[model samples]
Target: MTETPIHPWNTPQSTSSSASTGLTPEALEAWVNARLDLHHQALNRVLAETDSRTPGNTLRPYDDAIFELAASSSLIGLLNSVHPDKAVRDAAQAQAQKISQVVVELALNRPVYDALSAIDAAAADPATRHYLDRTLLQYRLAGVDKDEPTRARLKELQDKATLLALTFSRNVQEGGNTVTIDNPSELDGLPPDFLNAHQPAPDGKITLTTDFPDYLPVMTFARSHNLRRRMFLAYNTRAFPQNKQVLVDLLAIRKEIANLLGFSNWANLATADQMMESAANMQAFLDELDSASRDGAEKEYARLLSFSGQSQIDACSRGFWLEQFRRSAFDFDSQSVRPYFPYDRVQQGVLATAARLFQVEFHPAPDASTWHPDVAAFDVFDHGTHSGRFYLDMHPREGKDKWFSAHPLIPGIADHPSGTRIPEAALICNFPGGKPGDPGLMQHSDVVTFFHEFGHLMHALLGGRQRWAGISGIATEGDFVEVPSQMLEEFFRDPALLATFAHHYETGEPIPAELVHKMNRAAAFGRADGVRTQLYYTTCSLKTHTEDPAALDLDQLFHSLYTRFLPYQWIEGNRMYAAFTHLVGYSSNYYTYMYDKVIALDFFAQFSRSNLLDDPIAMKYRRTVLEPGGSLPGKDIVYHFLGRSQSTNAFANWMNEQFQPPSTI
Candidate 1:
């Protein structure tokens, strides 16, 4: 599902920009209030009118208006997470809940629901039909079908739930805890360059924030076990105990909502609108993947214990030991490969590959103002015709979100009064940034992340032009949304694509082909652990939503799952679920990560049959899987693209091969 962004962007040229730099906190606050009121007026006109064809009386116009709000609210949401100005960030946060509540209320509005329900979507265009269809489904899912009291209660729960979700995410973003390093010797065994860049504290004490750049280095390479433990505990436990209650309340509320919605549990209600259809099916799928992945995870953990000669493996020591084992066993070093992946060079490669794949062009928009100095905007074009634009915010800083993602805020549609609508998206990440002289370098894994997000961006760019705003761009089922991104990751894993841009930064030398081969060799080192970790979360997600919260012990449930699946022993006081922001939007849906991987690899299997850059195959993917967006069911899209349904054969084989012993026959 597309996450609603918390930040704003420059609106389309035909419309006024909702958010830009140099706006005061008061101005932002007033604008959000006024904008929401304006949105209500526009939507109220639609809701009040009985005829679907009258002015402001159709699904398309309603969609266009709500999406305008979505664009602005998401932009503010993004700014709340990453904007440097605390005042602006604070303002964004302050007004976010209000906007969220408004969105929920709008979905719950009876008049709007009745208006959409009265329309006969059967005779509408395919895209319009899709838009009306999904909107009606969303309305029912939003509890519009519930009787008055139940619906009112659901609204209350929704309001609270939205706040909780935002708070949980904010707690994580705020870094619930930070580890201070008073002794410089504790940083030993880490790269000298990283130390020099991160160490700036007085009294010779360096501070480590739980941000990925600071915390990951310490976890992966720090020699001191205590320091590593500290970092791990800090990272895992962030927003814990506090978010624990919030999560409990959130889960309990969802349970009630589900029961009211005529479902057995929250998971049922959540998946009713998704491709999974039922919790049982989701559990069965996860169970199958879990059973297959467990053996490899166990073997790898045992290997780690034996390799380090340690009695037990904890979360903190896992990364540090994994690095040591990878170096000795596979003869591959992650840091050593970094010199070839400076962010700037990698960015170019991604853009070039994207342009080539889509037969599109990108020109940097120098005069295009951004929310931040670090953000770069580009005008996208296809075959000399304007497509849309996108913004990239790639560097890490205090208060920035810790993960990578793409937000397609302003959707592309053609029915606007101002001619064809332009799709606009933002790509956000927290990779380490460079200083004045030196440039930032990313791990190959990070490059894969970039590719994955770019795939989503391209999906938004190419697919969002659906005639209706509601049915545009990457709007497919949550299970199928990651298909293209995952397929793109396979492109990165390809030796051919890696060689195209893996050139050394300083020496201007191509990466040794040996490095890429070793990467593939060690790819399974943490495969089981990673997969199992996600499974653990999925199980918890299912349990929390499927079962009665009053009868559940969340901490016990979390620890039990961790013990059952993970290599590391669960540490006390580390409430990982609190920081699991996916619980908000993707509750009972964490399995999509693994489930989508199978589909991704299956789709990539098609490319493997021909050249990686086969134009025919690429165009087929773009036209069928990319262009239709949610106009067709995900299954239909895949069938149209590949001439058949995707199967488990390719994914199962890939997993078995990855987990099999290197000397396997």
Candidate 2:
């Protein structure tokens, strides 16, 4: 039988007036309290009805009810931010945590595991069996196999880790040093609006914040060496005062939790659901990449250093000089590309690419309620059939969530008793907004980011499977999840694809072919240095997570790791780990970026050989990989898609291609 389809937003019946209000803080708190009370009672009722041997059971209904309850609880937490009452907001967070804890408990129970296993074993159909298997894997990953005491401890550790992660991110977002520059010459190569945004002080200095929109331009383009160095240091040194200790404590807790769960290290525990699967493999992969790229990187660094002249090139000046050297050599910079990548046009380009690759249509939905005013929504149609709805929260705001791509609402089996088609999803991003008179254009990097995130958005929305929310889009192995998005990044560089959307914002002229070629050539210039830096982060994460927490001196450990792996010496008191949001979000799975890139390159190779827009290849990709989600093991999906065993050699080849020195003009 085909699995049931359900609307993504269908909610359980709630008689207590569905959380609307003109209520004061106290009344709002009371309303939240009442709802929590009802949910608590309902949960107890469901738990009582669910046991190891319940006959011809009510378990399915019970599970569905619990899922709705959990989703509603999470929604309340999200919506509470918009509440006028602080008390109501606090109450919603507390209540949501409580509900989440309970749901986690139920879902991680042995009985649930046994039931899922039974379903997997007994299901006659492949699809249903795959669904059950995926569900079972999620439970197992959540520590369902642990003894009661261990499970309880794991839950506590996870909860604490979640809260700590949030605190770490919040600290980074709120904390930063601001600088003011008097001379406009210091801001040379910056876009005009960036300069305008910062009001000049009565004394004539223009203020700058560490926000990416402000900082990146200065770092990339500023002519003032001292100013660029200062800004770069400040930007890199966020969360030092507050989050340093937090990182240490969080790392300790994670290590302890991993030990209790029978893993040798936190990396092992975290990577269980990822493609890499262990710290050793990740280390090996990094080591291989480092070995392969070290010569190329050193050569690139030497070329950059030579451009600065021996007398001026010191440790302090190297970074600033290197930036200048790159611009001089490439003759193409981010600012040069921005005019060709206007925000609205890029969105259309992204949608157009999707239309060709996946046979989907996108239409603007300007009326949708969004978290921020700048956010835009769209209705996504499958071959002219309405399939899903998505909102792009593109701009940043005070107290808004930070950078990351997410499906706040994932498409899945709808909760309707009479199954309805499951509408797909929404994607949120924190891209920058442009000021008046200038269209908000993106850099090529930003264009690739749009494509990458949309790749994820499409993965969530287009998967035609029913019944298994576990196997939906990004719900797959963390390491493997990035493959689809990474593959999409290649499209940004494709001339055919770029021709579709890349045009001058004001004049509507196509980006010159010569410019495109230059851009592509320049793309590989700093690749080795870039890849090496990423490897440092990935390696440091693995070391911190795998080591015995009590033995680690967080500062010294990070410093030592950087000194050993990175090309440069470690700076004292540089607490980069403190601001590493990925450590919290991705934890020990940080190596997933490289892991997925390997597969992504392989996938892109296939598209390069075949026509990128070939309908048959696209369908095959959708059927074998995208649609299957977590319904198959990552290895199985990859093998099936490639028709062969996976290899890391492709990653090495891609890196080689990237690190190849630019031919002399």
Candidate 3:
């Protein structure tokens, strides 16, 4: 039986829809089947084309299939992470797995590849030609040209890889462990509201889960070393023991797949299509970052260690000591700025800043139906023409995924037979303050994170209006994807920008420039250490895929890498890899964050600091950097905007900015 189509964005802006009233499990299954049928039909049409291959007869149908499948897969995939109901989430996971399998099978489909190969894209427009070339390259990479038996095996391995990835992520989402405080006094040094909200239960004990809201504050502000240690263990070891084997098996499968594909290792295979080019290149980049940050990291750690009077700062105690050091050295208390960054106001500021910078307007879709009441939907208009829609699911809850990200739910295609398909995206985050009377006083870092994710949302929406769905939105190379997000983070440091939105929750007084200055100075001190930490993760991700999985000791590798890049004494039970969800999606390329940081900083430096929001450069950046999406190669995008190759000089200068004398007002 067929169900009524409920395309994700089909819900009107004025209607309130919850998970209970939204698509049920049965409806989701039927919807998936319907979409898959359309996908198959489109591909079949490509194969059935009797005339010479043109963009319309062949590539158009192929792109249509991709666009349709993405809509089903992306929306259902998001349900697995954010849908409040477990049953819906589980069904979504199953459907997503099924969609993934179909994708793998299509990638290996010989007939479609042959048909696409026949197309003379030389006669087509530049974007269409690029689309064809990229598609052909991807097909070769997917082993569509392999012998029949090899193709079969590759498909099987890829399907298993998909399942393993799902399993690993599900474990992390559902595997949130908790720490219990035996004495309420252990909560001392935490924010007053945090202490109030976490009052002892009837047994006079407080329980904290590994969710970000609970874990971050405890790690940063708690005075009790034992409490911080316990919280760190709980947070780090999430999905441990279980995901350990899962990861090992997944890596082994990836290694085998790489071998079959004639690649040296999974790292080499994964990066082949990206800007990094090769694993050796990735290593060289990481080494440069390591060398650049080494001395500064050492000095920063020594300063923190001396300030704490502890012989060695445990990994768990790093945030605690750093906070104290910032207060003592830079005269900044992170908590002192929290009053000005209530979640709602920070949200307004992010929207306003983006609007002013990008020349867009955001209107609240108050009556829009979302999976949860906490989610806020907004429709975006550029120069008064409706552009796209975005959702803000910005709080934590039981059974929700713990990480923050922007999920593109619907791929926007500019030219479709039915109509122009406008894009839709959501920010799935775990920021504080969604409860009644809980202002969700965000740390300045949280405000930065909000800007970071919104950057992705903007990318998805603005870049979405392309002729082809495959190239629409954040479809750029995997390595280039983080530039927009991280670049937006730099804007959060602007005092004038912060003054526009950061106001005390009760008093409504804007944050003082002096406080903003101190906050930024304190935040800058950790840049080198942050870079080192990223290197540790980047190295771990690279090594895991490059090294043999059968004999690899994950614990030994993790601990060794930590010691190599960080000065913190490693705790015995830290299994951060288990909960490192990036491993599932990013695979062996966690270096993406650091690599893109270099580009992001270079891009940020192009804007005039004094007129950041109103700078003509902002609009130029939107057109040259963000608007192109994946239609152009990343290097081309960078060149068009910055007129040169991206430089690490900007990042290096940023790393040392904390040591530079403060600029006079």
Candidate 4:
């Protein structure tokens, strides 16, 4: 039942190691350079083989190189996002660019592609065959067989693109802005814990940052319109004027690269390797979702305007009005549930729920070193078998990235000479309440987010026990990767499950069922609007990638898209695109959220709603959909789990649930 443990070695044979936890900037740089050297040595071994190519001689070395880069580069890249020291973060960024250059070279390497192409995978296992097929397809997509000059140009352009992306993300990560409130009375409607956290300075001035902990509460609860507007402007404009040009340059470069690769645009090129298949298909999917949710969104907006007795609501006021509407119409105040979800309790609940559903236990790894003292590490055990390790950096701090994401640090490899390489991952988030006295009272949505990100961590660890590192955990199509996260989000609504961990911080009383019902109903009221907003973002992502970037006006496109999908009046000077980090990662495929939502809702429908913890379908889903990793195609994963193609019926029903009587379960 025992799996391999991590070792503190400097060679490629080492299964696992800590991130740049205690390393100085120079040591971190040297560590990355050493890993790159090992990665190159592995690739050189693949090329030096003169005998007949086999999976052993060709694919194994290639995957080992991939494992080397994935194991080290991911952690190094993460430092730029979450590391506390600016000097280390900067060095990590430079090293990250260097790793990207190596990646670009490997993608365009001719001899390596030739060696892999020579492999006869007919006698190999299905996973190995699939791995080889996908690798060759990617090589072809990278134009590996193109002329030397073209490949050289592509390499240069890709390196530039990589640098631009890093610049864009760095701007967002370091671009947090602050707003000052002169009068304490203006903070009315904010929760008491938040007020305590932000007591006025001796000069009688209170300051707030655009970080989510401050931004979400202030936008959703603050009573002052001017304050909300100021916060909104500061938040949406983060990295603005700086990332603006960087995005333009990135798009232009992407378009050029796509043209060189024989695609219409970056959207088409990006989707070529994804589940959506094509940009036109992506548009069709978005159109179907829009048709399904537009009517519901219109009704919800009408009700909101009527409730507010206002002709039009600005962007900053949407959340505030929605909160007010929910309180008045559904008699549910989101704050009422806060005391039941203190950060520590919520963390315990999230871990316990995952353990029960997946049949795994989490043991705290207090001795594990992490980049920051705040990060908590845990070792996962399944039926007495050591599975993997994970870290949770779940609180906000100055100079940290302002986003919630699951980052895979090291890919698990089963055939290492020493033992199985235990996978490692981390969750970087900025939720509320991490201070000594401020019992991080989580919003209901924050709890849902916690569950959602854990879904990804589970996927990484469970699916990581694969033969090929290339198709390991979370290697599924980019569009399909969100299914697990989104599906787990639904579990947060179960009353029986909620009682297991959600309790009052002081009194320890489980949240009442009636209150849970009201919260779900109130939460449901905004479903359509949420969908519409997703569509707007998805379209913006698609349009910017598909259109001519030189002619595209980001501001005008944002305004037009906003009006087209939403009922709210556009706020001037709102530069959301400047901080749209997904543009750097997902490119035009932000529709992945909505697209995967359909599949996720369909998947969740298969579970026994009343007894989700013990449902056999949970394990079935883990095996068929999650453990397969990318060994099977995305469509096959869906079919294997659901016995058919995913349907939109569940999503449609979810959108209209607000109009129906609340579920009695």
TM-scores for the candidates: 0.93, 0.86, 0.97, 0.97
Residue by residue across 1-665, what tens digits does model 3's lDDT show? 43435453233321234543465777677778878988998998999899988888899899989988788888888889988778878988999999999999999999999999998788778778778888898899898988999999999999999999999999999999999888888998998989888988999888998888899999999999999999999988999989999999999999999999999899999999899989999999998998999989888988998898979988988998899999999999999999999998998899999999999999999976677777788999989989899989888877788889999988888877778988999999999888888898998889999999999999999999888999999999989999999999999888988999999999999999999999988989988999998999999999999999999999999999999899898999899999888888999999999999999999999989998889999999999988888888898899999899999999999999987878822
Q: Which pairs of residues have clashing backbones in candidate 2?
A: 6-414, 7-414
Tens digits of per-residue lDDT for model 2, 247-313: 8789888887778867888888887766677788788888888897788778777787677665334
For 1-665, candidate 1 gives per-residue lDDT tens digits of 23223233332321234245565676667567656765776786676665545222577558766766776677678778777788878888878888888888887888788877787666667666666777789898888977889878888988988888888888778855788888888889887678878675777778887877788788888999999888878888888768888888888888888888888898887777777888999989988888878787778888888999989978667789988998888898788888888888899999998888878899999877677777889999888888889999988766677788998867788566657878888899877554576678888788999999999999888997877666678788888888888889877766667778878989988887777878777775777677787788889878888878888897788888888888686666677787888887688788787888878888888874336765578888899888898777787887887788777777666665656666641
Model 4 CA deviation exceeding 4 Å by range: 1-21, 663-665
| Model 2 stretches with alpha carbons more than 4 Å out | 1-59, 62-96, 117-120, 137-147, 310-323, 414-417, 421-424, 569-571, 609-611, 658-665
lDDT of each: 0.79, 0.66, 0.89, 0.89
In angstroms, the error of model 3 at 122 is: 1.2
Give the Å error, residue 618, model 3. Answer: 0.5
Weakest 10 consecutive residues of candidate 3 by summed lDDT: 8-17
lDDT per residue for candidate 4 within 332-387, as digits (tens), equals 99999999999999999999999988888999999876777888999999889888
Clashes counted in candidate 2 amount to 2
Tell me the spans in candidate 1 whose CA falls farther than 4 Å from its real position: 1-20, 48-57, 659-665
- For the record, the alpha-carbon RMSD of candidate 3 to the native fold, in angstroms, is 2.0
- Cα displacement (angstroms), candidate 2, residue 323, comes to 4.4
Which one wins by lDDT: 2 or 3? Answer: 3
